[model samples]
Structure formats: C-alpha cells, structure tokens
Target chain A: MSATVYIPREATALSLGAQSVARALAEEAARRQDAVQIVRTGSRGLFWLEPMLEVATSAARVAYGPVQAADVAGLFEAGFLTGGKHRLNLGPVESIPYLKNQERLTCGRLGVIDPVNLDDYRAHGGYAGLTNALAMEPAAIVKAVTDSGLRGRGGAAFPTGIKWKTVHDAPGAKKYIVCNADEGDSGTFSDRLLMEGDPFCLIEGMTIAGLAVGATSGYVYLRCEYPHAQDTMTQAIATAYAAGYLGADVLGSGRAFELQLRMGAGAYICGEETSLLESLEGRRGQIRFKPPLPALKGLFGCPTVVNNVISFASVPIILERGAQFYKDYGMGRSRGSLPIQLAGNIARGGLVERAFGVTLRELLYDYGGGTRSGRPIRAVQVGGPLGAYWPESKFDTPVDYEAFAGGGGMLGHGGIVVFDDTVDMAAQARYAMEFCAIESCGKCTPCRIGSTRGVEVIDRLVAGDRTAMQQTLLRDLCDTMLNGSLCALGGLTPYPVLSALDYFPEDFSTPAALQAAKR
Target chain B: MSERKRVTIPIRVEPGTDLPAAERTAVLEAVNQNRALEGSLLPILHAIQDRLGWIPPRTLPLIAYELNLTRAEVHGVVTFYHYFRQHPPGKQVIYLCRAEACQAVGAVSLEAHAKRALGIDFHGTSGDGRYTLEPVYCLGNCASGPSLMIDRELYGRMTPERFDDLIAADAAGATSAAATSAGATRA
Candidate 1:
C-alpha cells in the first residue's frame, strides 16, 4: 500500500524549497520501489520551520519540520511513514506549542485541509455560516455582526457592521462588497495565509456580506506581489462558482451575488480604501477627498462595502457561532480574535491568532522565543511601516487597539517586526520616510514633498549636524505630514519617524559624538 | 527626491506605425479579451506586459482606442503603476525584497553583492541582456527574510553566497526557464 505524505503548497513553503522537497520525496520513493501519495495543503504558519512535512498516521498527523530535500532517504530508512521516530520529527501537528495555543477562529481550517477541495471544505464547517445566514433576515445578520464587536481587522479599527449597515441602508442602482486583499504591509501575511489556506472562509464571508448589504457584485482587489495567492484564490473562486457558493444564486438562497477578482498594479497606497477604489476604476491610485465615504458612494459611484481579508474572513464564523461567542473572547472595546504576525529577526516567527489583550512581552518571549540571533532585543516595530517603534520598557503593554493607541502606538494590522540590539533606529526612521516617499500617491503636498524633506532632515541629523534648529525642523515636518496630509499614508507616517526619534535619540547622534559623550 | 512618477521614455507614436506587427496583433487581442471587464484598462495593460514583457509605446494608442479613452489617459494610467514596464526587461528579471523584514536579515549586504556581481544598479539591465534588477517592497515571506524572486519563482532566507550560487545556476539553466522564455520570446 502507498503511504500518504503531505506538503504545504503555501507561498512561504514554496519559497523555502517545498517544491524541491516534494520532488525529492517522490523520486526517493520511486527509487526505493515504494509508493507514496503526496497531498498538497496550506501552510500551518510556522514559517521558520518550513517546508514542514507531515505523514498521515492512523492516530494522528505526524509532523517533521524545516525539512530539506536531503532528508528524504534517511527518513524512509527510519520507517517514518508509520510515525516511527526520526531526529527531525516534531510529533503530531496539533501538539506543537505555537500552533496549539492559538485561538484560530477565522484561521481554523488553515493548513488542516486540501486548499482547493470544496468537498474537503464542506467536510469541515465551511458554509455553516451561509446556511444559517440564508435563513435569517438581512437586518438580523447585520445586528448579529454589530453585537459581536467585530471591528475592521485592516489596521483602522473601524466597526465592520456599521460600514455594512451604511451600505445596507443606502439606496443605489447597484451596491458592491469589495475585499481589500491589497496587503502591502511589510511584516504581515495573515491576509495571504487566509487567501491561500482557507479561501472559502473569505468567499463565505463575502457572500454573507453581499446578503446583508443587498449587494449583488463583489471584487477582491489583490496586489500583484502575491501571484501564488492569486493562483490559489482564482482556483478557489472557480470552485466556489461551480459549487453555487458564489455567482447568481449563492447556495440556492434565491438571492444573487457575483464576485470578480481584480489585480492591483504595484501601488502600496491602494491598500487605502479610497485609493483602492480609484485603482479599481482604472484610474491613478490618488487619494480622494472625504464627505463621500466609500460606504456612501464607492466603486464607480455605487454604495460599496470595503473590508480587509481578515475582517471579511472573520464574518463566516461570526455568523455561524452567533454574536456573543466572538464577543466573549476579546477585551475592552476591541472584541474578537486578533491574528498577529511575528516577523523579522525573531527566533520563531509566524502567525499567532489569539484573543485581544495578549501582551507584547508574551508574544515576543513566550511565543516568538526571542530574537533569532539569540541577542538582546532592542526595538520592535508594531503595526506595519507606519506603526510605532516600541522600546523594551513598553513590552508589557497588551495588544489591544485602544491600549496601543493610548500608549502612543497603534496596532496596525497586528504585524510586529522585531530588531536586535544591533539595529540602527536612525536608519530605520529614515527608511520609514523614504518608504512614504516611494508609495505616496502624490495627491497631497504634505506626504508628497514632506517625506522627501523628512528623509533629508534625518540624514543631516545622523550625519553629525544634530542642531536644535534641524531637530525642530524635523518635528515640524512630521507634524505637517500628520495633520495636513489627505490620507493615512501621509497622516500616520510620523508614527514611525517620531516614535524612533523619541525612543532612540542616541541613534540620531553620530558614532563619534556617541563615543565622545560616553567618555 | 523625485517619485519616479512617469516613464522616463517619451511616448509618441501613431496607432498603425512603428510598432512590431506581431505584438500589435497580440496587443489588440489582449485589449479585446479584457474590454468588457469593469475598469478594464489595468487588465489590458497587464495582459500586454505579461505577453510581451513590457508595454510598447505604440500599443498605448491601440489600447486607448479599444477602450474608448484618449491616448494620454491610457498613457497616464500605465505610468501610474509600477508593474507595467515601459521598456523591455532583460531575459531574466530579479526582484529582491528590500523592505524592513528582509533588511532585518541582511538584505542590504545581499543587495550590494548582487549589484556588484551584475555590474548594474536597480532598474538596470546587464550589458548581455541576461538580468534586470528591481526592488520589490515586500513578497510577504517575512519570517524567512531576504526573499528574492527570479521571474515567478520565489526564494527565501537568502544570503550573498546563496544568491551568487542561485543566479549562477539560473545562468547555467539549472532552474526552470519557462517564465523567462514566455516573457522574453516577444520582447
């Protein structure tokens, strides 16, 4: 009989030699005159331990981690197919501490099933939400979500149900439900994982949104950087259309909803809702003025509901388990589970989906296992590029949206990038400004010209010209960018730059000056 | 200090003149295939670039004509996006993630090594037309830092040594050449 072997088809897995490992497993099996069936599944999000391989045992799925192509022969020789012991064996998949501790609501099906298999999805609790949603009134669905305390997971912390309610109440010839999958954040992969791993969750979520908002049309504005995600999502969408989870009659509910996958050409600003709307309309991704919120008039002047992948993906479970099940998990105003990504120079970096209020210290030490270099951690940048650089003193702060905002940091998209003691905060601050300059839509002068000037000021400061006049100028520039800019791309850039300057002022001083002052 | 907002190459061409005859047909075919899509300009531009590796100057007017927009409107849209190339790339395009995640794991050093080895900076192709280097903000492989993508294939946890070896292997045809050929055939 042939043994079943599982490998991840996810992006990070493929990037880390999963393809070659799969090939080696097959070739080695054939050469030994033994048969092996390879099952491609989504990643479990223990990314540093990829391409993690699993074998189907009768009792459980036995896991082996960080496997290279070179480990194939020795593994077979050790009788590893039947869950026999090997040096690299990570035991059962569920027993792993990092994955075991996670409270996976939206991400429950990730890495647990064959990604593109709709039957496999149904075998799991795939469309239970839609099934229940089809029986309920649309207003009740909106009220359930609103009562569940589900806010937009895409950094802004807006109430998801309120946006849906706005779209639900608005009258238009056509309404839209747009999933902002343009995840351009530097240290975030939660959106990509869900899209590639459990795409049906997003589809079901979108269907529920369409039903709630009376929108018949939908679009997923995905970034061009994620071609692997595009391939997986496209396949999943085709599967969905075939299975009646999408298209004119969703799950035979006698209602209509249609979805189209749209590609965004490499503009980070498109992650912003208004700019994304502009790009979806085939125009330049420039920031639009407010008073016409996207909920009121969006997507070619129609009432559109734009939500992030995580936000949309969270909807299915909210609908299935009802409101209070989700509301009971989180803390304070920020309710429901938060999927936090740990990246950069961390010892064990991956996605950690937990209820809100988990502290930074716990995420960094208990889960992340400290820096990958085994050095003292100096700084950690919470949120994406526009988030604040928190110091060691602030490690105990809980990962609540309001808590972070109160502490001069915002948990933007829940991505945390760590840096060791060797990192230069001054250079990081300059890079933040430079990143703003590169991705800015050039609509407002504050972000367009202010970022360039900010970079020059940081350069001058670190180049030993740290005069008070220059420092004041830098502060004033950040203030202008914060208050005067049109969008968050311009408005929130000071979060990183000023946070760096405030947290690590020594980094802004030249090495010579530092040496002299220390003496 | 400039945003690299517009294409550096001045675009001026008649609809039926100075364009490669075969690619023009391919361009028109791409436009027609996507003309019915909502906000189809981006889809058309992507199709042309995917088939030909870059959008030709003359093809812009053709796309505009098919989409019922002006040549300048089409031109503005194409230049606004970073993915659509105005000039042809080399046989193999290398995208190195220079974002903060990759930087934390030694992307800067690897970037310098790649530049020195290739004898060209970012957005510059080698004299042999074998390689073109582009800086990608993020490929979302954050845990395994210093990610590099050669054509459509992605590699992670890259070091200067590994980068050198991989590109050498690419030059020697050890890696898949399908993406390269599909992009290079009409360029």
Candidate 2:
C-alpha cells in the first residue's frame, strides 16, 4: 500500500466538493493499483477555488483544484502522481496568488497538513511553539507576545499580551484560559474558518497561554452557528489529548492543563468576554461591568485569560518564531499581519491576511475586484455591525487601527462589507439600530432602550419627517448612543447611522412627500 | 453528579403576539435544542422555521420556558435574529444577503428587482402565498459576492438578469405546487 493520504472533512471543503474529488482520486488510484495515497487536507485559505487537492510528489507536494470528479480520470492519466497536470494546475499550491499573498500567522498550518493526523502536524512544524514556550520563563514568553503587537481579533483590539500578563499576575489559586469562538458578527466568519481550516494552531496557542498564565484548564467557547467548526475542533482537541500534547503533564513537562469545549447559546452578547465566562459557568449570557476585567475576576471569579480564536492562534507562532519575525510584517503601530475577512457585495470575497495599512482602494478594487454587479461602488462597512460606514470618497483610508480610527472606522474584527450604488444608506442605518436593539444585553440603558428609540427615529425620518429640526434630532440621538453606551454595541451603533446621514443625505430626505417637511 | 443550576430573570413580552400551543411547542423545541450553540440565535430561528413553518409570538415564552431563560432572553433571541419570523412564511424562502459584501456587488439593485418582479416587499410573502422574502447579512461566499440563499443553497454572483430567470423558473415550479396546496389549505 502507498502512503496513506488524509484531507479535511470540514464544511468549507464539503461546500467546495472535496468529498467528490477525494472519492474520484481514490477510484483512480485503485484502478491503476498504484501505490499512491491522496489526502484531503484542510483548506489553505485560498477559498476562491475549492475542492483544492494536493498530491505527495517525489519533489514537492503539488496542488490542483476547483477540480471536479469528472476531471479526476484525466488527472490520473496525465501522470498526476508524478506532479504532471491535466487542467486544474495551480502549480505549487504555495505559489497561488491567494495563498502566497497571505502573511499567514494564525492560519500558518491550515490547509497544509492533515487535520486528523498528529504525525503530519509534527512533520509540518506543529507543537514547536509549545515546546519553545515550555522551555522559557513564562515572563519571557509574555514579553515576546507583548512586543509582537498582537491584539485581539474578535472585535475588540485590546492588546493580547497585556491581558495575558494581567491574568498571569492576578492572585488566584485557580486560573483559566478561554478561547472565544463565539464569532457572531454579521459579515464575519474568520473564526469558524480558522478553527475548521487549522484547528491545531488554536490548540497550540491556547496551550501556550495556559502555560504562560499558570492555568490548569482551558475552554473553547465555540458558537453553534459553526457546527462543522465545533466538530472539527473537538476532534483536533481529542487528538491532542491522545498524543499527550494536552491533558495531565503535557509533553512530560509536568504542567497540567486540561481543555474542554463549552458550547454557547445563541446570544450575540456572549461574544463579550465576561458574558462568555458566565455562559461557561452554565448561566444566561449577559454583559458584566468592566474594571474587574476578565483577567482579574473572570470565569467563576477566578483569574482567566479570555481571548478570541485569532488572538490565541497567533500566540504559538510568536512563541516559536519569536516576536521580531511577526513584528516585521505589519505597518506603523499595528505590528503584525491581520487575517482580514473580505465579505459582502463584492466580486471576490474571502480572507486576505496582509500586513496592516493596505488601503481600502486596494482591498476593494485590487483584491475584491470591485462589485459583483459591475456597478458604481457606494459605501463600505468597515468592521462589523458596530463599525462605521464609509462612502466611496473615503476609500483612501488605510486598514491600520490608528488610520481606520482617524477615518471614523474602528477596525473591529477586520470585516469589510462593500456596498454598491443601489444601496439605501438610510435603510441600512435603520438596520444598525434594529440589530443593536435585538442584540443588546440590556445591561445598560443606552443600548437597552436607546437602540429601539434610534430605530423609531430613523423610521420617522424615512416616513417623511426629514425636516432640518428632525434631522438634527436624529443626529443627536446617534451621538447619545455613541457616547452613552458601555460597549461598542451601543457606542459604535452611531457610526453606521451617522455615516449614512452624512454621506447619503439624499436617501434621508424621504421622497417628495418627506421633502415637504424640510421645506 | 453534575448539579442542576437554577437562575431566574424578568422578561418583557413584545407588544402584540398571541399564538397557540402547538406553535409554541414547536418554537420552544427548536430553541431549547439549539440554545447552547455558539451564535445559536440565527440557526435556532432557522430550525423553528423548518419545524413550525413560522415564528409565532408565543414561541418566545415557550423558548424561555424550555431553556430556563427569561421571556426577554427568548424575545431578544427571536427578535435580535433576522432569520426568525413572527408570522407565517409562504411556501418557499428566498433570503438575500444584503451586507456590504453582497451590496458592494449589486445586491441592492437585485433586491429592488426581486421585490418588483416578485410583487412582494422585503420581509413580505408573495400574494400567491408561494414565497417569503427576507434579508440576510452574509453567507461567507465572499469571493462570489452578491449572493442569495434559496432555502439553504447559496447562489452567488447573481444579477438582476440572472435572478429574473431564476424567479421565472421558481415561479413555474411554484405555480404547479401552489395550485394544489392553495386548493388544499383554502378548502
């Protein structure tokens, strides 16, 4: 028998027809009785063409994809076993534009090795970070992460190393490491993609965190929206446990760190770290006050390191390769690569991890290839629902946190949603308040009640109350939500609402009937 | 043995919603089964739609009851989520992703085109009672933007022209089935 091949059984691959491709390759290998093995590895982030297949050649592993089962026979006949090609030639998988352009820090091992095979992960540079981390003083490791300039990728851009150090220093007998996989943003799926595409990186990142913080337990609070991700991560965790990479006395270091999966109920508020902690304790998810910040009194009142999947996934690489290597990629203050999730109304949408400071023009025109409708671009929502809306004129804004912030957009989770000319900014603004009203944890007054009132004001404006006085009132309402709300949910809701008013005033002046109010 | 946790919180009911028992049970079942899911609200609502065909007002309390959650908790989930329906949906679901990705690609015009051709407003059912339309955020088919989900299958890079053809074909399919179902439901 030839060497066994394994590939990802994740949903993205399923959606891309990996099942049929794998089956076809198997049948072809069988017919020839060739001693060749075909493995279905997880996606390598080049999701543009799926059914992406890789072959173990004598020279290097060759890749081909967006392949149909119909093409398998031709591929086999074309000496594909020897790296020859039929039609689906993507020449060295690593060289593909989508793969090569990415400065994959967190997703480095994804789509590269067999997710189920621990041996494969080891061969391709897995667990190296954990070994390196274990050898160092926890303080040294923390210093390296802090110097790397990595921030939380799950909406909030809090410095990850600072959070870890706080939890590490917090006085507590029991501590915890929690991976927030509760990615509930409307235009975001990077967390799910990372977990399913490269589960090990996250595991390694969490293990490193546990060791750094003297925590004995870690929990991955994954959202249910990603059923496939949940199953894939669970399997990866099991494999890690079996191989002694996790569980008691990991890798003979005598360091005990146990990890478990805590599924979240479908509350967007749960994406907030403290609420996630409460949910892990098996209670209803509601946002808690800050200052006690999760690092001090989190997860059953024990010091906890709560981080998003991407932030934790970034740790292993920083530990293994050192902070300088990671720090070399990004621009200005945002020193590291960001796995920017390109989504919504664009021609080409997918994850693009580049050094920060890429312009919106590049993201939209060059990478996204303009709108799918071949129409004029209108507005873009940078960040998630709580992020700001920018008109076409503001496309010059750079993606760095400071730059985006200066341009009135917070780089929340790096989710950029493009809109074409046909968009009604007014209606989209209304949706912002509506979404806030629906998702507000109701712990704060501004978010709990202001969101509903905000929606009504927008509704009234749309219903022909576009008088100058009324418009001013609407603007004032947005400011209240902006300043008064506790979290970004309320604080940033005005970004979209106000931006719509500022850039698309024509949309606000309700048809002729509504214009009468202005007169 | 794991201890059962008991927690209680007050909840508010929406202004107007009084549904029957069966509908409530169906909604609750969907919510309870899915509550523990990370980002579960949308999928739970989707499940409720699959089970009971619509989201009834009473489903909120029922969901609260089963999950040991408050009425506001259930209400927040049901209303916060865009997928759930407080009223009955028509036979087929045609949800368009209107988030920036789709909009950047022309989903706005397509939505207008769809609404005009279908003769139904956004979030409204067709007059013939065959299709219910709704707006969604994103489906993660970013590379193929301007996408729509008919039932659960994502159709990407859609244009008003292509959607017209799709709607025509769908209308043809709906007509034959509607003829039979309409007769049965009305009769």
Candidate 3:
C-alpha cells in the first residue's frame, strides 16, 4: 500500500475540472519518487468547493482544494499535503459550516472513503448494523426498525419499518428485499450518489433487511442510465461476497442472503414499487393493483419488502444509534433526517440533509441562498415532475409530508427544484402533463389516456381558451385522474398543472389579441 | 438533408455473431434470473439489454422461447423503452440530454446542431464508427443543464463550442479504432 490521496469529485465535481486537478496531483507526487494513488470518490455535497482533495497521513487526513492543477507545485512546496495553511483556508474540513451542522445519517460515510474499497468501508462503521442484526432474532431486528420511525425517502414517505414488519409476519415460503434504486426523478441523484459513493451502506442496509424479514435474497433494481452506479454496486457486491458479508451464511451467521442488481430500462414509472417489482420479474413496468401489496405476494409470489435506496440506507444508523436516538431530531411525526436535494435555479444546489420540518422558506432563502440566476425566485417545484408547483406565498410550508399536502403539494422525495422569475408557469404545467404522457406504461386507462388528454387540455388553456368552461373541464379532469389512477404517475401529474393554474393565474391570461399567433 | 424521420427499430433474433458458449448461457441465465423475480417480461428484456449493449436481433427467439411468448410480444417490450436499441452501436456513445430543463437551457438548439454536424439523428451511429448519438432526459445535474454523458463521464454546461472541442480532443486521443468502437457501444 502506497500513500494515496483521494478526491471527492463526483460528476458534479468533474463538471468543475476535478479530473485535471487529480491528474496534476498525480504528476506532482510522481516527481517525488514515492508513488501517489489518486482515488476519485463521490462529492461531499459541498459542490461549491469541488475538486476537494484529501491527503492521507498518520493522523486525520488533511483536505485541500477546489485547487486547480495550475497550483499543484505551489501546494506541494507549501506542505499543503500535511494540512498547512493556504489561501483556500477551508480550515480543518470538519469545521466547515455546511458540513458541521448536518445531521448526516444516510450520508455519514459518503465522501470519506474510496467507493470500492471494502476495507475502507469496514473501518468506518460500515457493517456494524448488519453485525448487530446478525446477533438478534429476525423479529427483534424488525422491531428495532419499527421503533426508528424511518419512512421511505423515495417520494411516497411510506413507513419503512411497517413495510418490513409486514413482510416478516406474512406467511410465505420465500421472501425478498428489493432496493428501489431506479431513482429517475429529474432533480434527484441521492440514490445514485449512495450507490456510487458508498455502495457498502446499501449492502449493509439490505443485509439487515434480509436478516429481519427471513429473506434469503435481496435485489437492487438500479436504473440503466446510471451505468457508473450499476458497475460500482456490482463490484461492491462481489467484494462483499468474497468478504462473507453476502451469499450464504453471512459473517459466520446461519442466515443465508444473496444480493443482486437488476438494471432498469429507464422508465420513470418503474420508480413505483409495483412497477419496479414487475420490471424485476421480467415483465412490462405497469403498476399493479394494491390490497395484494408486495408484503403479501411479491417477487415469485412471495412476501417482499421493497424500499428506495435511501430508506434502506438509513437502516444502519437506526440500528447503531438506537430508535430514540434516530427519532429525537425531527419535529412532529416526521422523525429523522432527510437527504433533501436542493436543485434547479439555486446557488448552492446540492444535498442538504436536515431534520424533518425545515420549512421551504428557510431551505430556499437561508440554506440555498436564493436563485442562481440572480432573479427573484418565482416558484419552486418540490418533489419530482409530478409534485405541485408552490409559489412564494407557500414558502412557509414546513418540509414534512402533512404540511406539504395541506399546501396542495406532497413532499414526494424531498427534491426541491427552484425556478426563477423568468420561468413561465404555464409552460411548466404543460411539461408536467407531457412528461406523464411520455412515461405512463399504458397499463391503466386513467394514466395512459388521461395524461395525453391532459397535455392537449393544457395546450388549449395556454392557447387562450379564456372561457370559465375550459378551466372547469381542466379542474374536473385533474380530480378524476387524482381519484381514479392506479399509481402516483397519473394521480400526481395534475398537482403541478393545477398548482400552476392556482398560483400563477397571469400565466393563463393570454389575450385574444395575440393568442392566435402565439398558439 | 431534410429532417430524418424517426424509425422504430423492430426487434429480431440473429444466430450469427461469434458469441462463446459461456456468454450464450450467461445471456439465457440473465433472462431466467429476471423472470424469476416478478414474472414480468419487461425486466427480463431490460436485463438482456443491460448485459448486452443492444438487444441482438437473434436473442428475441431465445427470450420468446423462455417466456412462452411469440417474437412480437418480446419485441414490444424492447421498443417501448427509449433506453433500448435494436442495432449494435458504434465506438463512442454520445448521450445528449434533451429534457425540459436542458431544453430550457438551450439543449434543443444544441441537439439539432449536433445531429447536423455528425450527420446522424438520435440513436444514429456516425458513419465513421466514432460516435453514436442518443437522446436522454434530465441527468439530475440540472443546475448545470444542457449536459451530456460520454462513456460514463458526465459533461455539464455543454455548449456547441465545447462540444466541438470535446470531439477534437477525443479524435486526438484515439489510440486504436477497435478500442474506440467498444467505448462507443457502451454508456
């Protein structure tokens, strides 16, 4: 093993020339006779200062960067590798305000370790949760998860513990734990970051689930678009098997659990658990009827606990820190920290993990530092494309499921996409319907047909259909889709559409004068 | 040239192409592994695509035979997803984001210009076997919209000027045609 330096430069970091900086460091190290290995790790979510470099030493690793290749020799001469003072004065990385106050549970080990290093993973509290669970009865493990108050982070906000408990209690000869890594939401890549940045967290999370639910197998249904994440996870799983964390009788425990990754073909609807389940089973990704939920009859007609990447990723922390420790942070029933992705027209657009109920106003103005365009933030699209568009007046809406629902929006995946004053809400509303139309699996009439028709209606409305009759028809279609659709795809597509109509009525007012030409 | 009409490539199975016996078994096992999960046919098709870059025209019969469906039924699943391609790809895959966010940031103009420059539409492989163009939606790095992913490397804030420079750099870096072709087929 040689003295190595790791750069926490994700794709976001690469966009800022982190690769060149890494190469520069490698060259400088090479000139010194001693070899230096530059391992590219995931971003620390402090995306503002990417190309963040950490140099290994006997003590704590010293960090230096957002440094360019141009300054490599100067950095080396200044003894920056040993954490000497420099112009970048980030001052002992742990002291950085954005990172210091963060309640990092899911992202605890994100940028600290080499993504593929199984040994590094073990050194940093990686498999402790699995180790703890391996010592207990499966039912006891399920109870611990239940008490943690961890909800699904993949939009739905379903209780993770209850879902697992149901699978544990359900009568089935075979059971499964599926990680819904098909994170297709436009403004979200937390799942991708976790899988690529820290693959072991997901492995530990899945292993714990397998032990709790009496399941012998787990599958991570990753998106095809994230080929890097898929490859990272595949390598990690192989390493884990070699280390005895996966595949038959894990860690000397009598429990048998095998983990696999199933790649999704880039369909947005497959993010829906049932569709994901269907896709995993070699079928078209159409939503299934509830009632006979996956808890009862899932993969191969056995009880399966399906959850988003973050939900399971939160497991180790819950187990290690105990239920009350995990639950103590949040306000009200929305217990625990959420990995909120602040994206779109925002200055500091990256992951902001905070306790639940950190109101949108604070998150937008205080944390995000307002619009990146220097224009007034006109609107914010919280959640994915299907989420509602909330204007400035609703910014006070607390970042919790219930509060968001009361404000005519759902806290789908905690992905807050800000939009500046230059945005046309009418156009945004149309795109929402258009997105739904494109992604609907055509399994049900309401989603497949309603989405296409919704696009047409939105177009008509945009075309200056100034009559009250047209507005009424649009509202009625929204209501019908919300009530009749089988899944969130069709049901929530109207949220953005109707929210736009409600908040920005001026967008609907195309005068009859220029309407003909505009249309 | 006039705007090229989009062709929905039909799925077919081919028997030729020097696939080893182990690889053939691996492909069949991939189909079986996915089918055993949820009894869904689409996942199985996606699994095949994941392992093999594009759905080989010959694998449809193998998939069809396993799933107890005709060739057409299997074909439908492969074509439905924009991620799936019927033809074998070229050397370097250039995936340009054409979603709403990217379009809002001028991806539309960039995409059109790129296609014109390369003489290929989305899913079209350049005649020189250097690059294949693909259209993707949002890549989740929207703060720096108008992005492209070239062989697992995400390039953001992509402008026409930078795009030209990237192509030139890639041409200069080409050590071998065979290696470049392999890189183009994936990502």
Instruction: Give me the candidate number with maximum DockQ.
Output: 1
- Distance (Å) between predicted and true CA of A179, model 3? 0.5
**Rank list by TM-score:** 1, 3, 2
Instruction: Kindly list the per-residue Cα lDDT of model 1 for residues A1-519, writing each as its tens digit.
Output: 678998888888888888878888989999988878998888889987898999999999999978888898889988889988899899999999999999999898888888889988989999999999999999999999999999999999999999999999999979999999999988899999999898888988999999999999999999999887888889899989998888888877789989989999999999999999999999889979986999999999999999999999999899889899999998999999999999999999999999998999999999999998899899998888999998999999998999999999999899999999989998899999999999999999999999999999988777666446668999999999999999999899999999999999988888854554456
Candidate 1 clash total? 0
Clashes of 2: 29
Residue B33 of model 2, lDDT score: 84
Query: Fnat per model, in the order given?
Result: 0.63, 0.25, 0.32
CAPRI rating of model 3? acceptable
How do the residues A430-479 of candidate 3 rate in per-residue lDDT, one tens digit apiece? 88888888899888787888888888887777776644666788899888
Q: What TM-score number comes out for model 1?
A: 0.95
Q: What is candidate 2's lDDT per residue for B30-63, written digit by digit as tens? A: 7678776644554566677668877777566655
Candidate 3 interface RMSD to the true structure? 4.3
- Relative to the true structure, candidate 3 reaches a TM of 0.89
Q: Where is model 3 chain A poorest over a 10-residue stretch in terms of lDDT?
A: A510-519
Candidate 1 segments whose C-alpha is farther than 4 A from its true place: A512-519, B1-14, B177-187
Candidate 2 segments whose C-alpha is farther than 4 A from its true place = A1-10, A28-36, A77-81, A85-87, A513-519, B1-141, B145-187
Say which candidate scores most in TM-score: 1
Give the per-residue lDDT of model 1 (tens digit) for B141-180.
8988889887667788889998888878877887763121
